[model samples]
Target: MIRPGLTVKLSLLLACIGVIASGATGYYAYRANRNMLVNEAELSLLTSTELLGQRFSTSIDDVGADALVLASLPSTAEVAQSDDGLRRNSAREQLANVYSSFMVHHPEYLQIRLITREHHGLELVRFDRDADGLVRVKGDNLQEKGQFAYVFDTLTFSPGRIYTSPIAVNHEYGTHAAEGKPTLRLGTPVSNAQGAVVGVVVIDIDLEGLFKRLQNDLPSDYRVYLANEWGDFLVHPDASKAFGFDRGRRVLMQDSFSVTKPLFAQVQSEVRVNGLARPKQAAGQVLAFVRRPFGDSEGNRFIVIGLAKPLDDVLSGATLLGNRIVRMVLVFSVLALFLAILFARALTKPLHSLAYAATHLFAGHAMETLPLDRTDEIGLLARCFDRLRREIRLQMDALHTKQRELAHLATHDALTELPNRVLFLEKLERAIEEATQRQEGLAVLFVDLDRFKQINDQFGHAIGDKVLVAVARRLKQVLSSADVVARLGGDEFIVLIEGQRSADGASAIAARVVNALNEELSVDGQSMTVGASIGISQFPDDSGTAEELLLNADAAMYAAKADGRSAYLRYHDVLEARRREQAEQAERARAGEGATAGREAEPTA
Candidate 1:
């Protein structure tokens, strides 16, 4: 190979440097965006999984409550007890009619039976809902189920106590729709007049039906997975994978999702995994798993519920970003090569330093550092560069000022002139940190406007917007200047009260807010009457984190609405009601844990 000239070598070196810089910057940018997308997908999946688990728990609790209700009825005990002739027959008929009504209302209930404790667990009344309609199995058809766990296990419990059977495929002979379907059995012992465990009332819940309703609102791209405590798959995306144990083979969740081993080991209650991080296992998928307790204080039983989405779906935005980055790198590389060739050819002995200074001047060197004293052609060029730098600095300053203005607009609401959700959350986080350091208390008030949607639909959004602005103003006027009042979005506002404040103090603030918004507002000659429901939650009292605090406050706000509009409720009161409900279940649940009622927030105006 012929040795190249100094100019050619220098040009090649400069060109290679420029290409590497562009390629490295593009690569890092692409990676950062990809990682961010994956992280957000993981968080979203986890939230969906948690919500689904809560729903499943709630459904199971409802079924258990129904079983208890039937057991408590006097007619069930009369039918189950050993009695003479017409009276027992009439009681059986009455109870059967009730079971039929339940079947009609809940298509998911495959069978409801009242089994006697005296006749070796003989079925006294039974109603089954098959494909055609509700069928009451009578006479010889009502078989004895003394050996089954749902009967024998339930009869051992005291009155009001619920027995939850393990999930399994129903294989009992003469069963209607429940036969061959995955079923969950809930049973409660029926007591006589003297409060003795005389019989058991059982309800067979179709597992597939319960899950179908729970997953109805989820996105179509989502895949649901469920497994027992033993890691055996009960429900999977692939039908063949589900109930594999019944088919004489075993398909385990932990075996498929290696990251889920921690869940089986009881090391972690929740796990999030993405295919991009580990392509060999969950290839092209992002998954979240949560371990939820399945039974009412029985056997310490739990189930793993998971949701998965396609990696391609989650990374769609990142893919677009990567393509843009690739184009930018290519253009920069070509431009750098052309400029390197020209610079190499033009640089002479004296001009080389000048060229180097020109290249680095924009990189953050002072224009005064250039050789302006030399009265030559190079000096003239240096002076020109100095002048150009000054002009660019002024333009940069103006650009920075514009950027700050845009940032303010992004964080604050244009309609209300108050902090928006994004800014409010940031401030809440900072306040929480300060409160924790100072060992002080803080509170968050979640305010929701009642009847705002009706007004918006009747009049127009313009008037509704005016009402929102008015509401925001009144909220600010009601709260002290030290407190932060923010409009979270249409018909909803949030307040952050920092410093030491008792629950009573927060309630006082909430009451003032409710009264303020409850007043009639005349917006553009239209008299609009709006009421406020405020929920208050305190830091370190209701929750320690910002997200939990907001959620608690939101829950309390709904309770206020439920009590009656234009009222305020503390988050502590919501917890108190839940505590009372759970206390009632304490007799039935050994763990003293039961389903807490949930309320949905109203749609934004």
Candidate 2:
């Protein structure tokens, strides 16, 4: 019986479509924005790498220039020829001055060391700014044999051209002593006038500074790393004891090997694959890497710079937009449901009213009209219901009238036009109340036809019926207007007299009723005589209630039967006591019979 509303169905469908469209749009926007951010980050990283590479190349060039100037010195040639103390001291002083000037110009460089072309071993000198900014010569017997592998290798392999390599440098020089650490040394081979290698000039730049700069440039949510070709960490932001000399403990190199192993292998390849200048791949994470060579002429060294940004920040706005769209759809659904319910109620209100009105009309009540002002289908239904209600109301009215007539006939007697015993009792209660309020007595007289059953046995029941009906009419003719007479079934009739002065007054009315019933005759060509026994009981004197008064009156009428069946008796205490004595005597006689039977059952001896 329940039908769905059009508005609700449409709204639900629209909400579903809106949610899907919004989710799709949000997903596309998030992907586009994420891709744009990743491209921008890659460009920024490339620019930073190129800038850093230029800085490194320029430092190498400066070191080469200084090395050329030192190699051309006439004092440097004399020191190479002789092992004299004064010549060695002068060469050490000149080298110290050059190193001192280089340190002042490039503060990032820790120290600059110049090695000579002699087996006299190594000379140690430092810039002594405390001593009038001059070069101070130190021990000449200091051995450089074990610490100069990179320098020896450069000279042996590429004899004439400038060579640069990164090497571990000692930290015993002037400013380096205060720096409290060693560094990766950038060493360039010094060449003579004939373009033949003379010595090696080593420049120690702080690798930590480069690492810190790169770390600062990276986004807060991203991680950056610089690693060597061997996949060992040369510089990490959080450099601790674990990463000091234990190359195996480097987290960045291990992660790159595990996550981007293909990219790492491609960087190691001699030829580029896939048209990319540097091979890169993003697998389980979003990562960008660029590899640049960092040494000059001596050997090519790889510095892999990598950056990683998590995807959570990239997709956060998209997720929020999707959630907002879902919420809006839910809100719209609730609003639409509410409006749909209201509209449905408005549409069905007239039908519900018509149903209620039809129920009333079927129950034989007045029909109710419905408002038909609307121009919709509900309005037409209301008009039809109104016509149906009117037709049903007319049929109900005719049926109600017939029911009333039948009810009246069933409860009334045809001869006396008075209420029967059933109705008389009902009226008796009301009369009793009135009499009690008036401080007077009401009376119930039991009028019985003495030997009426014998009269019916002798004269036939049809004639008996006619005699009783005549008796009913004669009683009505004799009784005062204040008295009520009703045929109680068979030949028994009752008279209710209100406002009785006393029991004597009620007995006087009972005498009149007895006389009236004795005169009944003339039915079906025969004249019949029937005597009456009338017994009277006064309310508030004989019994307190209607039922008790009626019972006492009947008992008195029975007493009249014992007296000879043609007179009336007023109920009194003497009659009640005689009836109780007779009942006690009968009970004792029955007990005596029972005792005699018990005695007779004894066994004989």
Candidate 3:
């Protein structure tokens, strides 16, 4: 055989190296792409899980509010107090109608009952939804429930406070539709005029029904999981796994998903797991879990909400890319072998460019332009990277949305959704700066609710909360949209009015607030009224600083209260009187000092 030239030998050697290198790169790229896709899917699933938890909390609150409303009704209390038979009967009938109305509106409600603290927690009036519709049960049919936790635990609470019972299978006799079904009980104490807890208004929620509704909008493929504080699965895609503890043997989530053990211990608020990590329960899947507070209590009562998606679904794009990469490797090997003799040096630039882009793909900057216009394998790789960038940006946008929601929650009150002190001060400082620059003035109104404490004491904190919500709503209604209103803790709210620093202008706004609060209010069918005492202070005229302006307004508000409840006072009015008294005291001191000096100058020993 004739010996090949040196150039031919070099070409064959370079060709063999190119084939191996292309295959190795393809394998690694496939692995990296799979990881990236899994990460994005995990983040997305985690956000969705958190959102579901919030929705569940909101639903619980709604149920609690309904229970509170029933408990607060005067008729419910009247029946519970054991009044005259005729009067009690009338009240029961009227209240039963209201209960039926609620049941009609809320399909998820299994039963609504007023259980009296007396007669061993006898059900005074009850409405249960059966196979047909709402059925009213009364008289001898009303069963004693005092032995149940929902009744005794709720009666222990003060008026207006809600009690959320642990979710369980309802085994109560004569429960009709709720019998042997997963139930969540929300109860509030019903207090008579004497502020005695006479009865408990308890609403039985169909736990599965409620979650079904909550998850209606979720994708069909996504699986949901719920575990109680003990990690007992309360909800699972496979119904057989849920409520396993009720069946005797406990199936704990921590045991299934080992990584979730910290959640039960309150060590981690959230956790994400994937099949690649080889967590047994999460095999072939991606799962995200968030620990959510179960009730309004400060206790350790909580639930873990989780969402899972198939790993195969997450890797579908990666699979497609892998196939494309395999083909590209095969085509590029041939091209490399042909070009190796003359263009070996040219291949280094594209390979280096691809490597740099891959390394810095997530460094928070765009990759320097890639050679995407070329029809070669390098261009195909560049195009895949560009697509990957778009997918990442979409995931980032979702993360940004969740971040904004978290920031808003941090700055705003959870109850009233009004700006908290920190956020209010920030806004005030900005407003002050703007007003100073524009050479304009603004007004700050400090408002204190009168008789609120008395109402809170009589009704219980649950009703007190509703009263505050009502007050917040009224305040918003009284002020223009341009004005800012914030709750400064209990029974105190502050308002900022731009271009209204004049005494007349500020007083007019304050007057509107007082009048709005003074109007008779009806909550839960109980009539009550509250008054407002407002103190006004003007920016630039009162004080340039936000803190001083707030202090002056506070001082003026006290003056308003001193004058009488349901009144308004200006800071300047209070300041002028204080200034006169201070000046008189200074003059008197000077005169006394002069007299003392003259006596000393007489040299009388």
Best by TM-score: 1
Best by lDDT: 3
Candidate-wise lDDT, in order: 0.86, 0.62, 0.87
Q: Write the per-residue lDDT of candidate 1 for residues 1-605, one digit (tens) a residue.
A: 98997688778888989999999999998888888999898999999999999888888889988998898888888878873222348777877888888888888898999998876788888888788988888777778889998898888898988898888899999888888999889999999999888889999999999899889999999999999888989999999999888889989999999889999898899999899998887899999999987657755667899999999999899889989999999999999899888887877455564766677666546565778887988788888888787788899999999999999899999999999999999999999899889899899999998989999999899888888888888888888999998888878899999886544488888878777787889999988789888888899989999999999999999998999988988888888998998987876675333332222223331
Candidate 1 — which residues are off by over 4 angstroms?
Answer: 1-12, 83-88, 338-605
Q: Which whole-number lDDT from 0 to 100 does residue 474 have in model 2?
A: 84
**Candidate 2 wrong stretches, greater than 4 Å:** 3-15, 30-69, 72-78, 81-92, 124-137, 157-160, 166-182, 194-196, 213-222, 241-252, 255-286, 309-605
Each candidate's clash count: 0, 0, 0
TM-score: model 3 vs. ground truth: 0.55
- Candidate 2's displacement at residue 306, Å, is 2.5
The residue-by-residue lDDT of candidate 3 on 467-580, one tens digit each, is 889999999998989989998899899999886444347888899899999998888877789899999989889999999989999999999999899999999999898899
lDDT of 3 at 73: 84
